[model samples]
Target: MSGRGARGDADESGATSGSLDTVLSFVTGEMAFDPGPYNDAYLDRRVTARIRRTEAETYREYRGLLEADEAEQTALLDALNINVTRFFRNPDVWTVLRDVLAELTANNRTVRCWSAPCADGREPYSLAMLARDDPAIDANRLDIVGTDIDGEALAAARRGEYETTRTTDIAEELAPLSDLDAHVDRDGDSFAVRRPVREMVEFRRHDLLREDPLGEFELVLCRNLLIYIDGDHTRDIFDGLAAAVVPDGYLTIGKSETLPREFRTSFDAVERGAHVYHHC
Candidate 1:
């Protein structure tokens, strides 16, 4: 009777034999992005429903299911990451990046930029053009890193093969695609970034939440990512990012989101809808 009742309790709570252990692993383990504030019940719903596996399982038992098969890990991580990006996204923002990079490059000894959660190559690549067009900017001195939790996506960013479709926005900002210097390198269906700009960026699979994060930067572009995480997780990342920026450096977030109230003292709003942050 006692054994049956334990199972009954687990079943009623939608936590059968550790069924969602994999979910917890994703939040707290190697996949790296912080999980923030997941109350036990929220974990039960979000992870269980996210996996679409049987929900009547406990975290401990779910740990065993994960142990039984390690391959399930990637799919589970994929469920939580949100990848929504387009070339030269939000024209005004691109204009901001271009103008900002151009000015910073002119006077700064080194221009270090990070595109966190950069989906494929759009954001960093756009930064490349900002350098390419500005004669004062020496492409060699540029240090741009594109990091993401998704290995597959990071591979694509390194390859630099983007659909011709993403170029729709580029024509509006710079010269028509054909007139631009780099676009001239495309051979067929896909285009490769020319070497000078290509040399400036290096892509690596990085878990922003878990790994030893890089220390400092002139600008950090982490757009549309905070919306997926809870307030606690958001605050933790904001704290790390705040520390990562030079006292005079800048931080950027999604346009619709605001930094946690605690962060307001550390970061100053550079531009509002443009979603740019600066360490004042």
Candidate 2:
């Protein structure tokens, strides 16, 4: 296809069937997993974004570059996945989480939680903070697992470093509960979560679309991840997430996401505005 046509086609339908087939073949051949679960529009955007970054003249050229360069393949995979996240994002949601966790662990000594697609560890780390602060819950008894498909993001999570700008909003959100400084150590332009908080979370590489549940948990946070996936895959993923939650356990999704119609009867809304639900 002509370069202009390729660009125009991407804008209209993400990619021509032939180019998409080429790209998908290359990715699966190299990465050993299908990118088919993601929405065409989402894939198109990421593919075009990578094309622009590489300054390739056309989709054909871009596919050729991907086939030739292992580094480009990795870069394209990273680009296709969303990794933008922060600590204590949407404070109100955290508040709902805190209340639910408090109630869930009211009679128990241990509480387990999972944060799927926990990019950079901020979300699970935030959960760790709540567990540490709750008087009814013992920090020693709290176990939080953070899983993501991106090794790079997991590495950053392990490093526990963040720039001041990234933590500014988090700091503001935490000011009402406790001093943000107490949970993070500031050094120069970056800050790191305290060792105690970091210790509460364990990071692992996981693909929600293909992998089994990390294990049953009392709470599961799979927020801001479903929007990029197509409908059938989204339902498949939701089924896995629902099964991962213990009976009466809680599941929380992104503010903008909702439970699929098939799942609405199985999970009761605990906090509809916050997208928190109870597995029935």
Candidate 3:
């Protein structure tokens, strides 16, 4: 496994090295949740954190806990899903994406966009807001699909609700490009995306590791999720992503992630700083 867990030898909990494998097998075989796509290290780190939090003295205990507690299963899956995101998280990247969408939708043609692992629907909904606000783009013709492995996250996405405080920050941060005032209806303490904007986006449950890319897209935002994946499945995943983009379409990845060297011929680096590539 991932070499003695996250706590190293200091971890007195019986959930030591290789114990995560036993837990994983139990979750898959008994709990009906498969974590096969995750790297050993990533799984160990995330699962161990959960183990510590649940105060399970041993990996065997954690396995038994998972069997008895449905909530723990959901909690463990949430931990592994790693939903770290915010609306317009990077303004500079959104600025670039705006321009890219402009060119892709030049003739009022329908352009499809995929935000895989779209955490809590913020990214796709942000894209919709941006499209709706930009007069130059035909927002009605834009189609955005957000997919994530977490069903709980997907449920939240469909609800299209967010804390007013977060949306308020986005309104100020994003400025003239887009704002919540124009795209969301405020409730008591939260905001919900307007129907027009929500209509442009759809959410689905998808496992990026085991499933095929959903469809061809003019823009694919597969950011932040690749780092947790190990090398064994990296290239195959990259190959699928490469194949999913329409010719000349764009693929934007996390700042920390890079295209595999072998894909240099298939996708040309178009925005080096933003880690965007154009399918050639």
lDDT score of residue 101 within candidate 2: 79
On lDDT, the stronger of 1 and 3 is 3
Error of 3 at 131 (Å): 1.1
Q: How accurate locally, in lDDT, is each candidate? A: 0.65, 0.81, 0.80
| lDDT by residue for model 2 (1-280), tens | 1211233344565454235555666676777656778777777778878988886756767888987888998888888777989777778788888888778777565778999989999989888877776675566767899999989999999998887565355455455345577678878767788999898899999999889998899899999989888888998999899889999889999988878988889899887698899888
Clashing pairs in 2: none
Error of 1 at 206 (Å): 2.3
Residue 103, model 3: lDDT of: 84
Distance from true position, residue 154, model 1, in Å? 1.1
Candidate 1, poorest ten consecutive residues by summed lDDT: 1-10
Give the CA lDDT, 0 to 100, for residue 238 in model 1: 77
Q: Report residue 103 deviation for candidate 1 (angstroms).
A: 2.5
* Model 1 residue 274 lDDT score: 80
Question: lDDT-based ranking, best first?
Answer: 2, 3, 1
Candidate 2: regions farther than 4 A off:
1-22, 30-33, 67-71, 134-138, 165-177
Q: Tell me, what's the RMSD of every candidate?
A: 6.4, 4.0, 3.3
Model 1 over residues 1-280: C-alpha lDDT tens digits?
Answer: 1111222225565454433444465446655545454334444555565445734245555455454555655555665554667666777776566656666677647878888889887788777766766665565556899888877788888887665555343344344123465542655545667776677788878766666567678888888777666666776777777877777677888776678887788787766678777778
